[model samples]
Target: MIDKKTYNEIGVHIPSILLPKEGIDMQKWSVVACDQYTSEPEYWEEVEKKVGDNPSTLHLIFPEIYLEHGNADERIKRINNEMKRYINEGILVSQKPCMLLVDRSTPHTKSRKGLILAVDLEKYDYSAGSQTLIRATEGTVIERLPPRVKIRENAILELPHVMLLIDDPDKTVIEPLAGKLDSFEKVYDFELMMNGGHIRGYRIDDGETLKGILKAIEALADPEVFKSKYKVGDDKGVLLFAVGDGNHSLASAKVHWENVKKSLSEAEVEDHPARFALVEVVNVHDDGIVFEPIHRVLFNIEPESVLNALQDFFGSSCCSLEKFDSLESVNKRLSELKREEAVHSFGFVTDRSFGVFTVQNLKHNLEVATLQGFLDYYLGKQKEAKVDYIHGEDVVTKLGSKPGNIGFYLPSMEKHDLFKTVILDGVLPRKTFSMGEAEEKRFYLECRKIVKD
Candidate 1:
């Protein structure tokens, strides 16, 4: 169990984790993060069919794709009630205080490792230019929090999909834990549904192991060590943790904590369950973690008008387009272009044509940034047009081929540049990049109580 001193020192706590009882179907009990599959309602429909009348995380969390479909109030009520039911019926049994070490194996990527623990929200800040030890890697959209807040405010438990990144280049913290897995107890080992992946978790409750983990985290956070690693000046603020995924959820937790803390006394606030949010901290340099670019797909817009706007926005000198005969051609050219040059470029697939667009004398460090700037302005004028941040290039090709839709394929950003970029330039634009494909995202496996009993 983690003590108050460790919590204060590392801003992490060993949680009273809740897991499915031994008899329950583990595959049905777990689900992907709710925020995923926003553009694909059919995916959620399959999940609903699979989890029919069974106790599942799907019942506890609201999928964002359905956010605008109405009946949200009723859904929230049911979600909260289900949480109470799950706890009261012993479907979710409480475990001893410990951190969970997760090994996630997906078909497309290497096995990813993560450590799950409750992060103290008191030490986190997601607003612009936050210098807190835990910082957000992308800008938080304040407007996106209301729906999430509505779901979380009355919810009894939290099952996190939030992934935290520590810039541990030498693999000191989580790597060492892998060697000591035999000393800990195995918790859950099963295959995820809908071809998501296989996941296995082990409990880390040993006192000596816990202390060593905390010590390593402290070393990473040491100011001298941080400065030397980043080669930054002495006056620069230290950033120990970066929110790699689920920044909005973490921000929402912070918001809810801020609102609820007003009613608590100093003593009551010290170890409040709501004050800590559960997240998996993974090293940014982990071999298994792959950073993939989030491409854009615009709907309800004419392809010709989009092309015209792009040409006008960037002008003849800076912007140019080269046509390709097919999606395969576009993909082949993009693959080659990625290797040949450092120029800002994006591959596009529309109903009218397949092509690559290049922007010389780029304004931002990333091609996504330059494209996003234009799209923001273009969409403002073309009010009927809507944009969705997509994951894979193949998805973009398929979706953008539909009439009145266009997709922009962006190249992946270097994972190594994440922390340094966020520290130097504040947060990157929203929907900048994804840690992996949709299926590789963290599943909602473990739950923790947010309301004190």
Candidate 2:
């Protein structure tokens, strides 16, 4: 990550970080990304009981499960107030301007390396077909932006769970920090609540170390290097950072920044606090990084209606549905699928039926795209029906098995194809891939002052 002057080139910089004061129980302080466990109220219920009035991040973020409960404006007010209160009460303290090296080991993954920094919103565009330095790996859902923007409107602080991905196959940017852990100050080391696993952070304030990281990031961002890596010409912009997790959150931040900068003069915009958003940068090749498929669950729609909609969306000939008695068999068949590129298979589940839906001569490269195209068209026509991107196979299965709900279990993406695929093809369909399952996600720990006093 670069400092303010060069943040434009890499779209990343050392940020003025915020952390809980010493003696605060990190176990109760840090929680998983707000977006996770949306379909399960029980999960959040347990978390609330554990974090009960403990001055935790639970107070700072509005979990998605409670999004529809009511009083959204009131919730936003409470969030902004908590941010200011934390600052006033010294519950949150500024860590000065610096970067952090993170070593997180989840129950599922070990020693997953990451760098905590801020990304220039000006250098990021979440729209599809974006050629910016930091582009979203998946399509941005436009409707998801307004609510998120509302959360940031009056909020003074941001606790970022957006994990950005870099195609650093040479292990240059973040991996090198593991060897020099002794050179940095250990900031926080604790177990995350709710089986999120253990994590430790080291502050990177060394000039020489930061300089080396900047050089490595610069080399990766070189236009020639991007072209050579993707086998493309110089016509395209170099895509160094891809939004792997928290796509909508990052998109909302970009939207918020765009709105704020419009009222400011050019001079004011240059060093504006809201101009950059905090994020964790992780190498795509890191051993801890794995692309889990994001499953889809349709609510308030019958399985038969869903099938008919799909049939109408993609002409009957190219689309076919074959029924199965059990999910196990459907999954087995979908797993054995190694067919032509154009042929795609998906595992489908409903209260009454389990099936495999196949699409021939696919309109999109991935199964998620083909299905998302249909879902977008279908949902536009059917207001009562809505889709939610799900993580963890069990949750999706349970939700999909509920009455009046349909779940489409998806296949995972190959990590090797991510960078080149994004470079050649504009972006994957929204909710295409997740870094890990629900519990493995990055918890809200580091905070940054997004607005000046």
Candidate 3:
């Protein structure tokens, strides 16, 4: 198969946990990643009631909503206890080591296929100057790591909702595995609760298929080829294995491992399950994948304050476009303005008015780029201007239209440019692209116990 020996040499194992036949309601069992839609508690609450009393992943995990109010310590204790209980109860059946073929489909979309595998953590580096084989596509918010570390420190299992992307535009790696999915044994097939839709998985044990995947990954890792593909002067000593989603979760694993490494031996470190976190790898050019726009929300900022700030930032050149009653209307105007390349239209839904801010650029870069720089500086001075990245424009309008709220609807990043920008420039603006809308995210169904102590 793969250089399994190389992985072993690096002290990592690809242990897998599969769903039982009788308990195969994966849709309910597999919830979206804990970190997604953190602002929406009702969504999590609905999942709890639907998953109640069943052998669901919800039972074994703590929703991030409850993490606030000084309850995190208690949550971690309960999570650890439940993990131990699940393993002791023999509820989790271990599967033979192999790659997993995943296909997820929602009501409005077709199947989204992916391959699940473990990457060597030692090959990854998240630091700004890191030239590690595995790299982050955006700036990592360092402050988000501590709370995640607290959860992972005693986590008995690790389930991945994070997917990594490879720059292979051709059908080189994942496409071949998709063809063999039907030949392999089906591991899970069911509907996901909360309109998340149907999800099915297959195990890939064929030696030839596994070898192909390995060869493709190895080719991507070749320093000469990678540099030539990106047209960089030097290799930068890094491979563009991007964290498409779940950047914080990977960061969490990194943080905990560093802290625990001080007390472990070389052998112990190699054998630690934490050394290999499960992740799905997809080709960047997959027809099913799309980079959706993530918007910004500033809460507790008055509508008048927003107008004042806009007036101050752009002076008399700023003109307020007609108020949009619906997101569709706002989007139409934004599209119309984007064609001009000389003006920028911002959709803003405030208490005083639902309107667009048409600003003729007096200075700076792209309109969004210029606006972000000023927002960063403004929020730096005023701590109450809390910023959030929203997945849809509708969400932007819905959340921003609330009292004491303001929102900035940004355009989507062109998917084709993502790889080139990262390879040539080293990094892109943070939160530049989202794999898909919120529901398209990886679900948390499988789990690997990282710390058995």
Q: In TM-score terms, which candidate is top? A: 1
What's each prediction's TM-score?
A: 0.97, 0.96, 0.91
Q: What is the C-alpha local distance difference test score of each model?
A: 0.89, 0.88, 0.73
Residue 180: error of model 2 in Å?
Answer: 1.0
**What tens digits encode model 3's per-residue C-alpha lDDT throughout 268-305?**
88667677778888887887788887777888787777
- The stretch of ten residues in a row with the least summed lDDT in candidate 2 is 1-10
lDDT of 2 by residue, 1-453 (tens): 336465567877678999999888889999999999888899999998998988889899989888888889999899888888999999998987889999999988977999999988989888778899999888887987898899998889999999999988889988888999888899999888888989999999877888888889989998887888888987788998988999989888888888998999999998888999999999999999988999999999988988988887778998788888898989888876755456888988899878988888766788888888888888888899988889977887899989999999889989989988998888888889999888899999999998866
Q: Rank the candidates by TM-score, best first.
A: 1, 2, 3
> lDDT ranking from best to worst?
1, 2, 3
Best by lDDT: 1
Point out the higher-scoring one by lDDT: 2 or 3.
2
Alpha-carbon error at 28 in model 3, in Å? 2.6
lDDT of 3 at 329: 80
Q: Candidate 1, which segments miss by more than 4 Å at Cα?
A: 1-3, 335-342
Count the clashes in each prediction: 0, 0, 6
Clashes of 1: 0
lDDT of the structure predicted as candidate 2: 0.88
